[model samples]
Target chain A: MAKRLQRASETVFAPEDPEFQIAPMVDVLLVILLFFVSITSAETIKARPQSLRVLELPVAKDSKKKETSAGEVVINAGWEDGSGMLEVAEVSTSKFADPDRMRQFLRDAVKADPSLRALIRADRKVEYGFINQIMLVCTQEGISNITFAVVDKERQG
Target chain B: MAGGGGGGGEEGDYGFQIAPMVDIMFVLILFFMTAAMMKVSENELGIKAAGTPTASQEAQPAEIQLRIDADGTVSFNDRVIGSPIDDSLAALRSRLKEAIDLFGEKQPVVIIPQSTVKHERVIEVLNACAAANVKNLTFGGGS
Candidate 1:
């Protein structure tokens, strides 16, 4: 038995064959490549709730682009003493008081245009609770594109 | 069989070994397990999208946009609530309940946030909405 095992070991070298692993390596490489591709593809499509506010960047008006996009809802927010107030403004009119009313206004605005994005221009001192309400309203309206008007960090700094 | 020393072996004898594949699978399992452990520390809410994509045209009912600024003042839609964030929160609950009743339970409710708002204020709104039984929730960046 010892002599037979020694002879077998001499003849049967595990790494001797060049094509021994070609098929398996190719299969594994393909699988790994597929895994990475799927992971990155899914990431780009994944959406998340936004917390950062965007300030409008000035641009030259393009008539063709204006017709396709809806109008914007701008809120100029401020704080009084410890209380908070936001003035809802548009090209035509401005209304103040009652957060719920503003929520309704947002709903109406969204209904009218369906594609309009809400732009909140809030004072630095405004409280966090009011911000939450704005977010809640946006979620309710299904308005996904929300931008915050901010001073450029680089420019401001 | 080819004209080689082992060509005399049976044609049906060739088979691939699974031991290396098993090792690779074990490595993958370990990688995922370690990665999953890292995820447990993060807030799950922070990961969820508040609404549809920017171009989505889905119809939505009247929603309350609650803004909580850096100072903790609360607003619904764009209107600022009375002082003491709690009052605004209570008012928000009542209004939300009324809207839910009028628009039906499935209507979406969104929270638009500013950059400097306190994290605690956001949680307070979430708690208030949950308490009021408003299930449809979303968040977006706001001024």
Candidate 2:
């Protein structure tokens, strides 16, 4: 048994004919693929609520581009399909018709982080009056940092 | 994982299967390609919202008043700057650009749009302002 093992080691020189490691290579590819699949699923889940609103934002050719921040407060303004009423949302998927509720949410958000930015994602079809009300809430809350999300005309369809 | 690579190899016989590897690679490539197209980048235009009434008021400065009519007509300081529905607000952009070029970027602009006007119209006006480089912009015609 000892002589047989020594002869096997001598014949199986690692550098001479290294195995192509097909299994581990496949394992690495699978890991990468799984990572990407997870990322895509999470993104889809996160975007579902926002995409349900069907906001066709106006294309702005010269709107200053700013990156979305984690610390900022987002206010989505859109029209409800069934009732044609104004809908507002904070971070949750739930949409509400009450501006007062949005006001309260903004107030608390401001209280939590005074420097938090309020990003408005209003549908282009919605009347300016509704958006004005949101601006008023921001003003009342003393949270002056505001941003409007628009589709960039430079990258338009 | 083992089933995908599960075919046990015989003694000294490699069990590498190009078929499954090729299948997963194709699926991953297709998913990635589609994912790349799924993202829509949103650009932001920033402005300072009105301060709380209790906050100290800014000192009175020269303010330019802009009004958007229900018909999408925009007037700058009561002067007709052409309707966006007709001219893409080209005239407005030029006038604002000329003013910014002359006075400075600090020139404040306040837009007062009719309550019934579509927000698209307002954004069009805002887009023109951005093109013309209006630095200080306020909505609702307030100080």
Candidate 3:
């Protein structure tokens, strides 16, 4: 019956060519590229500055192990000699080191996501003056949820 | 041409091998994934930092004020307690717990840290507030 069905077709078709499938390979490559591009960008946005990367975080007995959620903007700060520097999402400006850029970023972020929260990671030796600047910026942008990163007091080493 | 620069005569039959390119891309992706995962996770303590509200003429509730000085001294309601030398602010914690018991967790608590105060000292005060389960927490000026 299969031979009769094949014989019934009057159309003549081209012969099947055996070769490497480049189209599927290209699709796989594109998918892989997209995956890494997205992942690396997210990690880069969450990256901290050098000061916050190595500084000793303050110890707290009540710090909770909350799973980090989306819509969080990390602000890294450091202060010395009556001056301070601010880095939002690992970006620091060459000009006078002001929070104007950070303020604008926060405003836009809050507009995009009303649930945006600020996660401040500052050095232990940094002065409150700097941290307050970050808090003021957050409040001004209508982001009332402020989180501070700290080490567990029991793990003081 | 001796250096095989644009000679176009060696293995020209194979236009481009996707196999080797794919291998290299996979390795690069693995490297970046590991680097991103290496970032250490940190514990977080949060506060709802809102703007100061305008004063009302109606009868108002009592507010608890905690002040931190530049020299690491912490004052609760104008009375100094807890030595900054100790890591654990046990005294301040107990007093804050007592205040919560009386005024309830909804009572407003303001933390005022001086300009030059170290962040570590300020966090100590916040630690005490967290232990006492203070719900209405805010940051205020160093008045």
Candidate 4:
């Protein structure tokens, strides 16, 4: 009985049997790495620059799923806190200011890449007139491919 | 027994440490997590900004006029369809579907929104058109 007890103690106290196996840990780490990499890549297309102001986009239940192409130009329209003018792509344009410069910029961009699409990211609180004005400018610049950026209703929560 | 055990230990055994590998994996995991969290998903609704078709051009498809007032009221062809309080915009959807059925998918939809109308209300009208499978959408000044 004593010999059996000694053998059992030796088996219990064996140092070679590690508490954690490296193989399973490695497998888990690899799976996590793959998951994160895929998720990051999937969301990278919509990532906006930090310098751009955050606009509360309107929610649309039937908004189509579209990938913004490489040459697409994104225009952000929102109200500036201090100035009562509409902010279009970081430029402040009041109701009186002629949008000739903005239109010229868009014309030059479209001239360079005719296939370039225009995306308008308008704030939810913004008036519809502001968006219409921008759309008119795009049409005048010969850019027919215009899109409005919005948030999916399901994702709003 | 000691000599035999010593000889056994000398057999084809190369020591490989796993601690450093685990540390490196942890660093990689941290980096990936940070990158994933920083990315955000952006969605878009396609709209074509083109001038009104002139009479010189080919026969244009039937055009449906939609209007939104500042108080979130939606109207179809000068007839008020739904109010802002209706979250689903059921009436607007049904009317737009009827228009789509009559004019087919090639029907042109022109949205005339008041200058004071909220952006959300405008999107609601656009969503109704999208649900009805109306592709050719145009934005026009208040009528």
Candidate 5:
């Protein structure tokens, strides 16, 4: 029966030499390229310069004000001297120079006040590396209570 | 599957494989590479210390968690304690002076900073610690 049908449809034609064309593939690729470019470029949020403002913290009512007799520790930033020394009260402290001395001073402060917390105020120009140094001292001395002082943006222009 | 690109001499087959498939593969590879690079660069915390360490002096290990934002704000644990940055350096100094006295022993304080946090801010924190005479420093990655 199949042979009879084939003989009856002898007028039908098919391509004897067919090959793949590169043009169609190129068209498909162009579509994909356009899709990607449009999607990636459509994103609007680019990383921008961060503006950091340091604010002031409220004073604790129960915390007592203890006077320092071993002189002051100065942790001043943005000084022209380039020395990252903090003045404790009025005395210049150089505990930053040596890790051991710094640790000793921290230990002493903790001994003086069992409920002691450190409040660090950094200048706008001071880098993170400098801040890490202070964190190191706190962790080493076991002074867990820490606070940062920032200026209110509304007040600082 | 093969032919052409040989000065049209070796084989009489002009019907060579299409180069479009190769171009698509290259594009896909490029896309994946970019995505991977972005992920790695997102949390680039300059943590000098990673693991945990026991201090020589403290019998009980104390945890000192330092929080650093992009601005110059530093927080220990969750509390925000301090005065205005410029004038309050002394106030900070006095606070640390007291804290150091309370700890009374050597313990490792861990500094965990954020990825986008600035370098100068970290330095100021360290300077404040030094002013308080607290030492023994270690670093960890930021949140």
Candidate 6:
């Protein structure tokens, strides 16, 4: 009886048990989690909010063009489909509207950050007058660094 | 005897659980996949502000004037180039290059686009100027 009982206890608590080991699996999951976390954070700089519709940017043949740096103020210029009006950063303005207010806004922004640059994301179908007006505002506000956002022609393929 | 054996089998069945852990990992993977799909790449073309003095008049050998009508017609130095499209852009580029050779590379090319012209057409003109190695560009006919 004593020998039989000893064999039964050893079988129940054996050294090589079939129990699941979590350490190795946990380590792998942690590595994958870190990789995804890094990717998501790195992408936030270029991602705009979903509420803003993307403009069909003009294509530039220069594939090696530089991208706008972070922290620069980006102003979106697109035609509002509903109202059929030109919208600059969500403000509806006429083709011949006064640019004083826009200039003042840029002036204040530049004053707060001297190294600030202005990036205009205008739609391809937009008229030149709208873009010129925004450029004029940027100049009058004393903001010299200005760039137009464009899509890479070669990369579209 | 059968009851005692059944009790012993039940005790041995308790081990580490892995189903919950795998569920959590799958959830995390789904979240990241969605986030990565939302990101978009952006590119930019640098243009000098109008009011800034990009080049001195003495350094500029000559000036080339470019005009774009409301109908996407492109003209250089008052002479209209070919139709304002990809095929005709080559002609515009050559004309711009000729001006660059006569006026020196530092010549400023001023672009005057009518308010009704499409912005894409203006960009095409700008691209042509860039291809001709013209560095100094200015926008005229104020908004």
Interface RMSD of each: 15.5, 4.2, 7.0, 3.5, 17.2, 4.5
TM-score of 5: 0.30
Which scores greater on lDDT, model 2 or model 5? 2
Compared with the true structure, all predictions reach lDDT values of 0.54, 0.71, 0.74, 0.72, 0.47, 0.68
* DockQ, every prediction: 0.08, 0.37, 0.32, 0.42, 0.06, 0.32
lDDT of 3 by residue, B1-143 (tens): 01122323466654554555666767766776765455444677888885745455554358888888778888888898866685678888898898889878667788998988889999888888898898778889753
**CAPRI class of candidate 5:** incorrect
lDDT of 2: 0.71
TM-score per candidate, chains pooled: 0.32, 0.66, 0.65, 0.69, 0.30, 0.63
* Candidate achieving higher lDDT, 1 or 5: 1
Task: Considering chain A alone, report the TM-score of candidate 5 relative to the true chain A.
Answer: 0.42
Please report, as a residue range, the 10-residue window in candidate 6 chain A with the lowest summed lDDT: A82-91
Q: Name the candidate that leads on DockQ.
A: 4
RMSD of each: 15.8, 8.6, 11.2, 9.1, 20.2, 9.9
DockQ rank order: 4, 2, 3, 6, 1, 5
Q: What are the chain B TM-scores of all models?
A: 0.55, 0.65, 0.63, 0.64, 0.51, 0.62
Backbone clash total, candidate 4: 0
Candidate 5 chain A minimal-lDDT segment of 10 residues: A55-64
Model 2, total clashes: 0
Sorted by TM-score, highest first, which candidate order results?
Answer: 4, 2, 3, 6, 1, 5
Docking class of 3: acceptable
Off by over 4 Å in 5: A1-157, B1-58, B82-88
Residue A111, candidate 6: C-alpha displacement in angstroms: 1.7
| Span of 10 residues, lowest total lDDT, candidate 4 chain B | B1-10
Clashing pairs in 2: none
Q: What lDDT is reached at residue A142 by model 1?
A: 59
What is the C-alpha lDDT profile of model 1 across B92-126, one tens digit per residue? Answer: 77777787778775667777656566444555565
Which candidate wins on lDDT? Answer: 3
